[model samples]
Target: MNRKILVLFLLILLSQNIFSATRIKTVEFNFGGYYSATDIASGSAWTPPYIIVNLPETGIVIKNAYVEIEYLSSAGSAADVTNIDIYFNAGTSATDIVDNITGTQVPDSSGESNLFVARADVTSKITSWTNQPYSLKFVSVGSPHNMHSAKLYITYEYDDTSPIQIKTVHFPIFSDSLDGISGVISTLAQQISPVSVPFKYRCDLPESGITIRQVWFEIRGLRQSGGATTDGSINVNISGYSSEPTMTLDGALTDTYRFRYLSSTGTPAGFAPNTLQTVYVNLSGTANTNILGGEVVITYEYSNNSNVKLKTVSYFFAQSTGTAGSVTSFTVPVYLNEDGITIERIYAKISGSYDSTTVGSIEVNSAIAGNSLTSRIYQIVVTAAQISGFEFYHDLSEGRSYWYNGAPITISWTNTLAALGGCAVELFITYKYTSENKYTEFYRVFAGQTPNEVASAGVYNYTFNLFFPDPEYPVGRKVLRRTWLRGDFIEG
Candidate 1:
């Protein structure tokens, strides 16, 4: 029975050892030390001894080790202090040299403490120690371990006073894979919409005191996706208006506006297939001066991972301006016609006054010989009370002449003027004859005149007039023409 019991006990011990080997428990060696100059003899000639500490016993071993040292300013005043060497020893004395190691030293010009590092052979030592069991020691040359039980060392002249000390720190090993994985995943998601945000603007009364006639919106998207690493995993789309009309003192009308998108963020990108993409709208018209209100819309689409996507939209509107008086010079297009001739060109002379201090712009359109002659458009602010008008000229005449007997020449004109307060004006149409052969045949004919009335501030009526030239002039190889109203006044 005793022999059988001994054999059973041996079997149980062997099973326990096998079980311990199969279960892995990770362990690390961390050490830290510092030396204070106050602990050393002030006037004695002595070198601090280097010291090293061994790690705890564990089934898992030290995989890696990092050592850093900080020097205290009070340690020494000697500027000649230069070299510092460190070594790893297997035993407690200098003879047991496990590995010869050196630390990187830095200069301290300000007499302040600096840091040093001993990193060579660290990886190889870690690999060997982790595979088996080993001991480690930290040793210094001129600097000795001053503390009674500390691993740090300091060396300096006793008479060369200033407090001197050394500090050593050791880092503990932990699981980096678990901590780093979350950060990597977060970084990957941030790249998808790094700059995808909506933008907004408003129309307000600036210090300059000028009512904004129109507003324009421009938007651009920078692409941050595509490459071997990114793999074109992201896509973006944008759509928005250039300008949306707002209610002004008068009414709403299409005004000046533009929107554009490009491939590159620098200049306008050229339109190409499978390159950059863009969408834009230009909203421009006369603002409604009477009831101040208006709005514009913008939309976008974002795609990541080809299967995941997002959409966003936004809008902007106009604010109201509190003022009084009927808007005169309401924005409108003027029209005109000339009878009994082939109309070559038609000019409308305008005369008016506006209470608003700002100048206004004018637009014109016309037709001739069954062809739409709508190319001559002009814009100018009415400042001085001179004659402001629209002129229409044809590039190619449809074999039609303005001077034929009883030829009914038709002329059309349209005008748009902007201003504030009640406005009243008179427009005059003038006609002239021009030919390549004779510079002396140019003259004016019967002129047509009319008056315009403004019902509200910032609003005016666009007037159209027609005229027929007198039949008493010589009819052979000549043109017939008429002139409309021309004059001016001041707005109240």
Candidate 2:
């Protein structure tokens, strides 16, 4: 038996369940076209993004684990159809397995030319396949010239479980405090995303934790506290999909819109467990003039080896930068603990407005200036006619001593309305700090808009955006006009 063995590797990387869907595929490949004696990466349908999809449960039999090996025998002479041997765990070299299954081909006519098809039963190995990668090897013997490989059949059942889980939900309330020198965070503020922003969430998906059935982006319409209702459609945009889905607006979600990507061909390199994935949501669409803010949600379904559940998660994107002429800004916090960590950099989302007709310019400046580390003065002209937004990044690594005791930095934005209303001013600060050696803790700040930041010092929250019957502007806006200075200081 001058046996010729073929080795192939298949990738059946599963995705997090986003929708309720299942996929069963017959992975196929050719040895003569793929199995190379020396070259590792020559030809392979046995490569990644080309494997079988199964559940996480152990001892589940996959009824579709079989191979249909095809080879043509020339007319006359020593050409004959042989038997097929199936093995688990395919490799790059010729190897023999102790536990193997075999199947024979219905012999084709030796007197005439014919195509030999061999069906091998591989259910024995599949019934107890591991959560790890599993591939089948097919061996065809009995002196057949020009032996090639064919398609593999797999029966995969989609469990269709919930895509996301609400691990925890923080309340809308916020609080903060000063610990010795540094501010100890008691209850951090809730993060809010502004309108027209593709606020992205770094999705943390568990390895093989859940297979993604379907994925969708949902954005709800925004309205003020006891404000007028909006009827017009809120336009939105979404990127980074396997295949962009169609758009639709209906019901209360009429102000809302949803999109789902159908194909789950995204590789293991994409949905590996314990890795961060990108889910971007942008409101580049038209704004509902009557709305104040909107909520962003990523809805999906998944399989957990047994059952499927529909799940939705509220992500890191939440902010309502309504019309240009409205008071649309709040302050976030910057805290550095006393862990001897060096302060390095900081970022902030600066946004503001004045009236429904006229607005002002927003400027971000610091008391301490590093020729290299200090962020430049950010200024933007605001108006009812224009929406102002600027991303401010400043490096605190230069010209400042490393923050050893952790302190607080106030980021303030000052805007003067062109209208007769009290100057509607808003502000936000940047926290640029760092640590030399990895301290007790290490985390990165964000380019963000905080609805609030909770601290251990004490809970003292305030809102001055009150309304009264005013002549110049009937809809009274918040006038928080204040001075700002940037500096680096040590807390004792």
Candidate 3:
């Protein structure tokens, strides 16, 4: 009989050990209360109070766990409480436990703790409070044991200034795993005065190159007071040089270069202020060349400002082409307004052996209006019989003619002519005639190398008086005579 009892005891002990090995341990918190057996016996109303719970961590696993809360009496001994409400992680509704006595007790084997409560119905669980204390009972559904924390809150009407009236406890439970998030990366490029600087970049991988989707940039360090400090803008282009590689890339390499303008930063100068402009260039291309290095050159114009620069900086990009290819190059043109000279009219005359073909065409243009004038022709020649007349006076005191005849005529003469010599006499004669009734008379005699030669169809006047042998008698006489006045003729 003793041996059989010993064997049964040993078997029982072995089973207990096995069960203990499979059981999972967990940590939980609860807000405790009591239930009345008389309430069930007499069918009285039972209202369960709730408690708040909190957890420190999130996204973990939980195994088996129970919650415990202590009942406090005014006299400091174990107190019997009724209508106890239980909660899990500050759940909304309370689960009722019928018990006549209360101190500290574990939930039942049904995974129903004295603090077990219903699920919460709220959007955000963090930093939120419920009207009851709650507890949760769960079994491990997956591997990798992890734990999360939640808040447990108890609701009770208390006297003013009572610290123990409202109590909160934290509890931990198993939850899902955490997920990782992605980060955003970007860059900016700008141009300063007196220089053009461009920013360049390259991905670590070249063969299977990186894809650049977007680019944004702005100019900084501008003053607000003067309009001199202003903002400028620019657009990026993808077209490359003819000698360089073409911008056309296959598949994911298309649309590799994009342009954007940046807003102004500082106040404008005067009515038209200097601006600090920013430009952005977006690139999206798969590198397929061995030479992935390149550069960007920023270009712009400075208006109403002198000694200013179009490009302030140049940016270098170290590239990994990823594959085998040559380096690509690109260029941009910048325009500016400058001060220029204005011409009204230009006159030119042709003389002596001027070649008609070599004369070239004459063109006139207006700088302000940007209009051009028609081309005109120019030529020079001599023709027909010529006769010229002039008066000469003999200046006895100066020993020279007061006025010389046949002086070279100029367009600038105002009053016919000016007496550059002394007093002289005037003589008239017709050319190619010698008879008394029709004599070829010379109009006047001047100091010239070819004095006999005359200009035709033109009037010649001199400041001196005429000196005929008999001045009064010869006034109206029709006679041709070769006579010299008493004066020294000046040579032209």
Best by lDDT: 2
Against the hidden true structure, what lDDT does model 2 obtain?
0.26
Could you give candidate 2's per-residue lDDT for residues 1-492 as a string of tens digits?
A: 222222221212121212212222222221211211121111111221233333443322243444444433321123343443434443333233322223222232233223333344344444432323345444434433222333334443322233322111011100121211111111111222224333322232322344442222222222111111222222333334332222211111121111111112222123222222332323222322221211122222233332211211111111333433544333332232222333322223222223332223334333223122233332222222221121222212233352233233333333343431222222211122122111111111111111222233433232211111111233322221221211111010
Q: 333-353 in candidate 1: lDDT tens per residue?
A: 222221222232122222222
- State the displacement of the C-alpha of residue 84, model 1, in Å, after optimal TM-score superposition: 1.2
User: What's the TM for model 3?
Assistant: 0.13
What are the RMSDs of all candidates, in order? 42.0, 27.8, 55.0
Error of 1 at 250 (Å): 82
Candidate 3 residue-wise lDDT, 232-343, digit = tens:
2222222231111111111110111111112111111111112212222222222111101111111111121122111111111112121223221111111111122111
Which parts of model 3 are misplaced by more than 4 Å?
1-25, 34-48, 67-90, 95-492
Off by over 4 Å in 2: 1-335, 338-345, 349-353, 356-359, 367-404, 407-410, 418-492
Displacement of residue 475 (Cα, Å) in model 1 is 99
TM-score of each: 0.19, 0.25, 0.13
User: How high is the CA lDDT of each candidate model?
Assistant: 0.21, 0.26, 0.18
